[model samples]
Target: MIAPMALARPSPQELWEMDRQHLLHPWTNFGPFEREGALVITRGEGCHLWDAEGRRYFDAVGGMWCTNVGLGRREMAAAMAEQAERLAFSNTFVDVTNDPSARLAARLADLAPGDLNRVHFTTGGSTAVDTAVRMVWYWQSCMGRPEKTDIVARDHSYHGATYLSQSVGKRPGDRVAEFRYKETGIHHLSAPNPYRRPEGMSEAQFCDALVAEFEALIVQVGADRIGGFIAEPIQASGGVIVPPQGYLRRMWEICQRHDILFIADEVVTAFGRLGHWFASEAEFGVVPDMITCAKGLTSGYVPLGAVIFSDRIWQAMAANGERWFTSGFTYSGHPVSCAVGLKNLEIIEREGLLENAARVGDYFLERLQALEALPLVGQVRGRRLMVCVENVADKATKAPLPDGVNESKRISDAAEAMGMMVRPLGHLNVMSPALTITEADVDFVAETLERAIRQVTDELVREGHRIG
Candidate 1:
């Protein structure tokens, strides 16, 4: 139950002024900032959100691909409230312990695939990834392999915004930019994009080529110098790039053969996003040495993330008896965050949302596939609830819309005007609604997108833009 707050919230105009005056948003280009004020979201409930002006929107993007169980779960609010009242703050720096933290750690250990039973919590996805990559250095140092100090990731992988994580992400613009950048030993391999691969290559051959590229890179980097290899099962924040089948398995084999520690950054795939609690093992058929997950961990109710390491690595770290290589956050194992996670996992299991995602996902993708009939649609691909609709000028050439045209943003605006909110990654429209979304909701979203794409196409065609 939501506790009744007696405080009067700021008006939309008031809030926007305050934000514009002081708040700088992440990933926003502020040179041409909106003078009328930003869209202020005042409240949310079950797969939907409302602006301060009372405009309701179906949140197809799931609050930046988090919000697994939708929104406004009074139980989750109550759980956090109870925990906050019980113990609001506690540092997990040293020997400190808390019930929610301890219990959530065990819960993660139980759910994590294979022997990835060790849990180290963090504030969010970026920190989790930052910590995991740093752990690779520590692991190598502890094991006396200090020469292995490099991190290899895909060119399209989205790790985090931290120095090490951002260094590895190959992107033109930041999800959130930073002044302090590093061009250290972190290297980026070619992104695995089947849609954009050379025309006429079979999926099998494409997979082999990708594996070969990774292997060649490892050789060039020198096996002894590379400490870890990381990848997202489904590359989120980078256009939801789903690689060819058997590609990840092959990559895993390559990493193992090269003695490189494999880390699966499942920040976007874990917790029912791909119809699995963990996709590193379930979807890809490879158990990573470390798995970093967040976002859906607490369903956006509380900030939390974790890196689950294998038992062997934990044992090795433990073996560093007298000496220690330490890295931790002030809110590393924040009790309130863990409590929310516990409740969120329960909701996922109790409602069988994972199974729901697996079942409804087929229908969802099918409905989305209907949009392929649209002239502007370049490709429609996704697994389970995570979907993308790429708008292209030429389907045959896979040519993106004219530079600076912002076709994706146009589609997003059209969708919003039609009562749905989808995220735009360049020309790709990303839709990852709540895992508990139904076939009806999928239809609504697809139909809205269809209308939006049609309108956007007409606009582009009239403007003399190239068309398929």
Candidate 2:
């Protein structure tokens, strides 16, 4: 039997005060937060969240684009609790191992495509990326090519906030303000963005240009000196950029020709966010030397991440028997996290959530695109449920709103006021609903989004703000 609901909790004012006084929020300006209370969310279920006041809103952000199965799955919770009670704190420290860890490793090997058979566990995406970086260096060292230590990533790419991951990501304004920025052959490539193509060039021509640029960079940098090239399959935090047709394939060919390792950062795109187990395999049809994934692995049940190593990488490491990669987090293969991940994967397979994302995703995309008729929407781009609406000042000129003006934030705030949760990624309003979302739920998203946009646009117009 389901447990009875507890009585309503204390007011949000109390919680906010507690948070400001005691909690150190990530990536926050503490001074502003001290003056203004934090957003105190209390509960979540399915595609909805309830604040301390019990106010419900559609969770369009999916808890930072991770919770693909949605909120409050008792099954996953039970699995975690059960594992915690049974054998919670075991370590996978080379010699010692746990059942859940071994099982999860095997399960990931089965799920991953190509010869990605070896699983190296980490705490989350950042650590996974860091692990990949270390592995690349180690592989080079093993192959007696220790000089091949440089990495290449695309502009607007987001790997993570760790030392090496941040070094690898080329996102503007994401640079470490305090640390010295390294320029160790980490080349940047122009993304296959068709909207901002070269003058008088079609998308096909633009794709060719981007490919040529990357290939030339590989030669200029001397491919022998570079370890690998890494990128998100569809740039998620990079404004949900869906590359031009044939773009990913060309990049793959370039990497192959240069003998540079290819890495797919699938942290945000894996596990049905884009209607696929692995977005790289499903969308681009390209395999990589290593794949990093987290976020949706356990659908936010517990902290988990992985670096899936291919057979070649594994063999190289194994060949150097005494000199294994000495890289692992203390909680890398936490038993509870592994058990929860196992259960979560079973849920995805049993419920066919991957297929569900594909089936219902078209409706979501179509309805989101329908919003382009609005003057405030400049573009709608995504695959499956991983969607984005880029706000522009003028559709004809494709100009953005004033810099320092958070138009996407304003729209998101408006949506929240209208009882829907939306997230602003720069000037782009984005959503990645639970993979289990229904057609009716998608319809509601469309209707509610239209309502929010209309309200915000009308207000902006009243304020005499220029908007597309």
User: All models: lDDT?
Assistant: 0.88, 0.86
Q: What TM-score fits each model?
A: 0.96, 0.96
lDDT accuracy of residue 153 in candidate 2: 87
TM-score of 1: 0.96
Over 267-340, each residue of candidate 2 has an lDDT whose tens digit, in order, gives: 99988888888988778988888999999999987999999989998887779377856899999889999999
Task: Please give the lDDT score for candidate 2.
Answer: 0.86
**For every candidate, C-alpha RMSD to the true structure in Å:** 3.0, 3.6
Error of 2 at 395 (Å): 0.6
Off by over 4 Å in 2: 1-10, 30-32
Using TM-score, give the best candidate's number.
Answer: 1
**Local accuracy of candidate 1 as per-residue lDDT tens digits, 309-385:** 99988887889377564888888899899999999999999999999989888788889988998888988998888
Specify the highest-lDDT model's number. 1
